[model samples]
Target: MSKSQVEVNRFKVKAQLMQLESDPIAVEEPLQISLVQNNKSEIFSLTMRTPGHDKELVYGLLFSEGIIENSDDVERLESQLHEGERQINQQEVILAEDISIEWSRFGRSYASYSGCGLCGKTSLQALELKQSRALKPIKSKIDNGLIRRLKALLAEQPLFSQTGGVHAAGLVYEKQGELILSKTPFFEDVGRHNALDKLIGHELLANDLNQAGLLLLSGRIGFELVQKAIMAGYSTIVALGAPSNLAIQAANQFNVALIGFAKDQSFNLYTADKNKVVCREPLD
Candidate 1:
C-alpha cells in the first residue's frame, strides 16, 4: 500500500492441481544508515526492512541504540537514492556538533536481518552497559478490555492485511476519559523491531513520548522490544504473541507491564504492579 508491498506471482496447489496467481508480498530491502557529525560521516548500521518511512526507521534505530538522546541530537536526515532510481536504500543522519558517539556499543559485524533485533550485540553484558532511565510508575489504571482490543486495531493495518508478512507497532493513549488508538503513529515492517523503531522515531521527532501510552506489538514480545519500550519510557506493552523469558525478566526489572497473547476475548499480563491493570467485563 505504501510502496512496501509488491505483487508477486505464485503457484497455488489444490489437491494436486496447480494454478498461478498473483499476491502481494511485503517488500524487504537493505538500508545502509550512517551518522554524520562535524562534516564526517560513518556507517552506523545495515538492516533489512521495508522501504517506506526510512527516515523514521533511522531515528528510531538511533534512539533505541542510545546513539542520540533526543530529537535535538539529530540535525537533519538525508536520503541517498539508488543511482538513477527513486528508491531510497541509504540514509545519512547529521548529528549536532556537541553530540558524542560511542562506536563500541554497536558491535555490528554483519548485516542485520528483519526478524532479528539482537544481531550485533556481543553479549548480554553489552546491553546492560547501556544506561536506561528508570521507568516511572504508571499513575493511571489500564483496563483489560482496552488491551484486548489492541489486536483488533492492529488487524486493520493495511500493510499486514495486504501481505500478512509484516509486523505492526502501535501506540494507545487515553483521551477524554476514553482509551484511543493512535491513528497516525502506527508502523509496519518486516522486522518487529523496525516497526517499533519507526513508531518511536515519529514520537521522538514530535516530542510526544512523555504522553502516557501503551505500546502494542503485532507479534511476539522479545527482549529487544522490551528494551526499546523502556528506552522510550513506555510503562506498558501489549502484544498478540507470546513473550520470551528475557522479556518477562526485563519487564519485571523495569516495573513495566508486559502483556502478551492478546486476543479478542482474553490476554495475558506477564508483569505489572498490583492494582495497576484492572479487569473489566466486555460491554454489550
Candidate 2:
C-alpha cells in the first residue's frame, strides 16, 4: 500500500518565467487499475486521474459502468503504485469473474464519463443496479438567491485557479436559503469527468450521501456527468455552462433535475420539478 501514492507536482518554472524549487502542482497522475477474474483477464482503464481516492475512483468507475451492482457484488479493491517510486500505487482490482471488463476498448488512456453515455449502448450485458424508483418529485426548486450564490461559489474552488487548467465539482447543500457544503470535499482534474470521479470518491468515503442536494460543476453538463448524478443520488445538478443533448436525455430518463448556464441572474431547468424561483417584473 505504500507504493499506492503518487507525486502530483514537480519543480517547474512558473509561467516559464521562473524555475522554482518547490515545484508547481501536478494535478494529474496515471492510475492503472487491474481487473482480475476467472477465464477473462482484468483490463485496466489507464485513467489519468488525480492522486488519492484511487480506490473509490475504481469503485465508481465499475459501478457506474454497470460492471458491479452493489457492495456485496464487489469482493475487494486494492492497489500497488507502479512497483515503487512514490507514485500512485496504481491498483489491481479483484472482482467476481461473473463480471468481465474489456480494457482494449478503454484505449489505455483517460476516459471521461457522461452520466448517461450508456443510455445508447447495445451490447453491455451486465448486472443492473438495484435502485428503486426515484422517490423525489420530478421537479426540484431552490431559492432564487441561493442559486445565484452557489454559482458564485462554484466558480471559486479550483486549485488551478491561477493556471485555469483544471476542472472542478462539489456537493452543495442549501438550508434556509444558506448554501452549506458537505464536509465530504471537492476535486479538480484536467478532465471534468475525472474531477467528478474524485468528488464521488470523497463523498462515498465520508458517507455523507444523503443525496438531498445538488452537484455543482464548473464545466458543462454531459451524459457521463449525468450518470454520476444518478449514481450519487443527487436530485439536482447545476452547471455553469450549457448541457449536452445526451445529458439532458439522461436527466429526463432518470428523473434527476438538471440546471445549466447558471450564472449572473439566469439559469435553465431541465427535466426537474419541485423548487424554482420565477422572477417577477420589477414595478416601475
Candidate 3:
C-alpha cells in the first residue's frame, strides 16, 4: 500500500447484516516545518498532511505564505526522519543568505488541520494587505468543453479512488492550441490547500508557473485557495465544486477567471476578465 493510505479492517453495517472488510483510509500525519536563515531555525507551521511529496508541500506552503518569492530563495530542504524509520515528520527549509523575511506579516504560528485552509491568519485586513499584484492576463481562452473534461479526469486520481477522502489539484496548461495536463503537476492530499500547494510547488521548482495554465480543484474553491492561485500566478481556475463569496471577491480583485460547480455539461463562472477567458455561446 502507498504511504498516502493505510489498510484498515472495519465493520461494514448494512440493512440486514454486518461484515468485516478491509478498507483503505487516507493517512493524515503532522509535519512540522521550520525555516532556517542566518543560522537560526524557527518552527512556523505544523500541518496535517498525507505522507508523500513532502518537499513539494513545503515549497507550496512557503510560496503561498509569501515566505519565498521563487524556488531560488530556498537553498535546500532537509527532512528530519525518525531513527530506524523511513517516515518523516519534520522538515527544515534553508533560505538563501540574501533572502530577507518579514516576520511581522507572518502573524503567529499555529496548527493547520487537514480540513481548514485559513487557520493561522491573524485577520482579514492583514491578508488583504499581503495580496500581490493582479495576475497578467492570459492571451488564450479556455474552452468550456475543456473545463467539463476536468471532472472526468478525477477518476485518474490514485489516492482519491482508493480512499475517497482526499482532495486533488491539477494544472492543465495550454500548449500549441491544445490543453494538456502535465504528467507530474497533479497531486492529491487530505487537505485541499495541501494538494494545490504540492501542484504549485512542483511547478515552482520546475520554473514552469509562468506557463498559461488552468488550476483545477476536485473540491470547492475557498478564499484561501484562490489566494494561493493568485500568488502562484494562475490566471484561470476551474473547480468541480462551488466557490465561496469571499473567493469570488478575491478572484475579481485579482482579475482571475474563477469557474466552479464544473459538471459534465455546465459550470458557473464567478469572475472573469473577458479578455482572459471567453466562454462559448449557449446552444439552441
Candidate achieving the largest lDDT: 3
Overall local distance difference test of candidate 3: 0.72
List runs of model 2 lying over 4 Å from the truth.
1-140, 174-178, 181-184, 280-284
Model 1 regions lying over 4 Å from their true place: 1-114, 129-140, 175-178, 182-184
Sort by lDDT, best first: what order?
A: 3, 1, 2
- Candidate 1's TM-score reads 0.57
Which structure is stronger by TM-score: 1 or 3? 1
Per-residue CA lDDT of candidate 1, range 1-284, in tens? 56776654433322223345654545555677778999998877767576787878888888888888889999999888755445787788999999998776655533464668446532213445232555544455555456555666888899999999999998876555555665536899998989999998988898887766778899987667888999888888878886655567677887788766666655655676535555555453
lDDT of 3 by residue, 47-74 (tens): 7567899999999989998888899999
Off by over 4 Å in 3: 1-114, 117-120, 129-136, 182-184, 274-284
Query: How far off is model 1, as Cα RMSD?
Result: 15.9
List of clashing residue pairs for candidate 1: none
Q: Which numbered prediction scores highest in TM-score against the true structure?
A: 1
- Give the Cα lDDT of each candidate: 0.71, 0.58, 0.72
Tens digit of per-residue lDDT, candidate 2, span 1-284:
22223222111211112122321222333455566676343444555444667778888887886667876666776656464335654576678757655555554433333321222222112112323335333233454455566765655765766778888888775455434654425688888888888887776787756545568888887656776677777767878776665466567777777776665555566555533434432222
User: Arrange candidates by TM-score, highest first: which order?
Assistant: 1, 3, 2
Better of 2 and 3 by TM-score: 3
| Winner on lDDT (2 vs 3) | 3
